[model samples]
Target: MTDIELGALLADASQAAAYFVDIHDRAALVEAANALDFTVAAANLAAADDKDALLEQIAEALQFPATFGGNWDALVDSLGDLSWLPAPGYVLLLDHCTDLRDAAPDDFATLLDILDEAASAHARAGVPFWALLPVTSPDA
Candidate 1:
């Protein structure tokens, strides 16, 4: 969705299975979220240089349980079984994700796929999950 369409999307979180936001600046998105009524349980991965960094950042930010095994399978299990985030919607902003995407494209793609799957599962339970990221361009 375009930037113009993003704010409304915050209120209407059922847009798609998940969102892979491709924007150069995150300030705009965060500003919009702050100005609006969207209560997001967000995490920023600007410092995540690899898979472990990514997992740890999310686990810390979202307060995942101790059972979170910090692996791909464990990540999926944790995401699909979120009971802590009781917000109207859950937003995960992977700020500066382009770095990780470039360094480990395979892992990044797997992360996106897992995030999308988690979004689908959460949507079924009436909770919106957003996996926001940055791309060079809109279609990237």
Candidate 2:
């Protein structure tokens, strides 16, 4: 479950949950996710009798916002849809965001808040937002 894969999955799920958008359509979300310079990492999401193999997926998907159409609020709104699900178990993997805090603290903070809201909404709706954000060491 590389960051890129995480982002794509997030986008796909968000699109479906909120806008009823089809993840299979050819669009910028998919294109930009594929175009980004991503890291290759192996990660997996497990389900009984259905193991999801995310090996070799790019880690750049975390930056999907950089390739989308809208402002931060709009982005938040789109993602916020996850909160409405009956039991949405969405996870976001931020692979290498060591610099995100320093490089763009305000933006990152806003992102955190928005995500927090979504998580809260999900919780209230009896849904769970499972997330992971692994960062490389500063020395790395």
Task: Please report the candidate that would top TM-score against the real structure.
Answer: 1
Question: What's the lDDT for candidate 1?
Answer: 0.74
- Clashes (N, CA, C under 3 Å) per candidate: 0, 4
In order, candidate lDDTs are 0.74, 0.40
lDDT string for model 2 (101-120, tens) is 45556655665666567656
User: Please, what are the lDDT tens digits per residue for candidate 1 over residues 7-124?
Assistant: 6666554653545565755567666565554445556777888999999988887789988899999999988887765565667776667778888899888998999998888778
Best by lDDT: 1
The 10 consecutive residues of candidate 1 with the worst lDDT sum are: 34-43
Task: Tell me the deviation in Å of residue 93 in model 2.
Answer: 0.6
**Window of ten residues with lowest summed lDDT in model 2:** 47-56
